[model samples]
Target: MTADTAKNFGPAFKTNWWARAGWLAGFLYAAYAANYLDVSWARFLQGLGNGAAFLAEMVPPNFSRWELLAANLIETVEIAIIASAFGILFSLPVGLLAARNLMPSWITWPFRAFIALCRSFHPVIFAILFVKAVGFGPLAGILTLIFASIGFIGKLFTEAIEEISLKPLEALRAAGAPFMSVIIYAVLPQVLNRFIGFSSYQLDANLRNSTMVGIVGAGGIGGTLFAAFQRFDYDFLAAILISIIALVMLSEFISTRIKRVFQ
Candidate 1:
């Protein structure tokens, strides 16, 4: 091979042994896990057959109890709205406080830790705890989702703040603007679009999650859906799934419009 060609292909800049080894290790681990878990083609085929049978049962969706279904769906939307509203509101300050670029470590650390703590638990667990505390209803679901939103929204907002350019901030400070003024003029302008996007996305997520929290009796459509499942009311369950699909699509349309307006 020519000298230049050899140089071009040399391991000095091209080698990434660590990465290759990591990939190999991951592949091996996945194979071992599958074997350990008894993941066989026969088992998979059996599962598929079972799933097909289930799907057959769910066909011909029944909305005979449309009144009850409608009430639960509305309650789910209400939970999502209330949770998203309060969560997004609270997340703003939490995000601001956690921004390492703007706040000192002492100030940022506690807030960051708190957000971390909020994120550590899954929404179902939070729903369970709140349900126990409040003794069932939409309030428990609302509280659960609020904490979930703060965790997700707070982290994203903190990251958005950290990614903002420091130039405007420096200029505003040089111009002797107060702390709040600096944030108002220099910070908000940059991240407002992203913040709105995050909030709307969280609202969308809360809507889906609200439906699930109800399974635990925290409120929404989940309890009804679960009961239907137990009673082998697969037709009704199918209707609920279709309604949820509609709800999500509606949210998606709204989110697109809101994003377009901001853009």
Candidate 2:
């Protein structure tokens, strides 16, 4: 509207040649990959035909073996809850230590690196490693989800801590309050609600991952689902899929409620 405002705003769009070149490179690479992979229209149509036949086999779910399904579902829920509890406990101190605004460089560096290491691998990869290390059982799944939760929750917690107002902390220190006292009084009050929200979200994620880890013999409903696939029991597979969907939806409902209550 005004000359000064127009001058400050400059042009509506600013061209960055480097960003343009990067996008062009990405598009070129995608095209090259598609060509190399032989992704043709004919093959896509043929795959769709095959998928239609596969869906025909899955038409009425079989819940005849409800006992086994229930047991595995219970195990999956247990693994998620246990992993979430342990992950929350372990991440609390690690996250605090990794907050650069709150801790020294020497302390933050190691903790931050540890969090990065936890995040570097996918939960499936961690599950496979733990399966080999701990033998085939729920222990492996628990460990995988725990590390996954720590990576996610710890990183977010550190960021939240960093963004907190430092005035309360400064006042506490000036008043000769103990370090733990200062943290308990100042740092936590600002981030507790956010931490609860993060914990609930991580729990939901863990529930889904718990089912997947069982595919590698980590112990849950995924093992049953994999068996159904291997046996060509599409009806049973359909039942398991429905069950997993229900589990995820239920977890989502609970997570939303928790966030609302805390808010």
Candidate 3:
């Protein structure tokens, strides 16, 4: 090799010894941790056997509880719809405020913090808190899911807003348009499709989570399913699980239609 090339390259590119050692240490520690956790082949076999028995019992789902299931399903849908609607509406303003490229740091920071706070808890945990604050019902579930949706879509919407083309926005400002008018003409056009996408995605997620919030007595099929499980009614639990899967799939279809329509 030339002297110049050797000087530029320094020593021959040897792998870092520490990095190789770290990998080996990590692998060994993972094995040790697994052993410490008692995750043995015997435990795996026992779990598999239990799972097989559970599946066998669930083969014939009990649709006899159709009336109860239907009622809870409707409640879950209502919670999802209400939560999604409110969440989207509220997130619009919050997301706009949180977009650092659109707003000053002082304005964006607090809004971003609020979004972070909203996103910090899972829907089920939020549902429990809401239930404690507001009592058990669809109302608690709705509130919990609303917070969840806002956390999700608000952050996405803010990022979309931040990434929007500034050319149009600058032109609007150069023309002496007010902030609101500039937002209407410049910001909205660029981000509206993305906003629709985020909203639809949140709605689909909310539908699935709404059903689960009921496990904490916030209201929905989850409560019924949990009760059935406690009673060892695997057939009924299986039926509920099937219905939830169907519901989520249907919601996904509807969300796709909405996205296409908006796009």
Give a tens-digit lDDT track for model 3, residues 1-263: 68998899887987799999999999999889989998888999999999999999998998997999999999999999999999999999999999999999999999899999999878888888999999999999999988998899999999999899999999999999999999999999999998989999999999999989989999888899899999999999899999999999999998889888987
Better of 1 and 3 by TM-score: 3
Decreasing lDDT order of the candidates: 1, 2, 3
Score each candidate by Cα lDDT: 0.95, 0.94, 0.93
In order of TM-score, best first, we have 2, 3, 1
TM value for model 2: 0.90
lDDT value for model 3 = 0.93
RMSD (CA, Å), candidate 1 to true, equals: 3.9
State which candidate, 2 or 3, has the greater lDDT.
2
Task: Tell me the tens digit of each residue's lDDT in model 1 across 1-263.
Answer: 68888778775577789999999999999989999999988999999999999999999999999999999999999999999999999999999999999999999999999999889999999999999999899999999999999999999999999999999999999999999999999998999889999998999999989999998999999999999999999999999999999998999899889889888
Off by over 4 Å in 2: 1-29
Tell how far residue 172 is off in model 1, in angstroms: 2.6
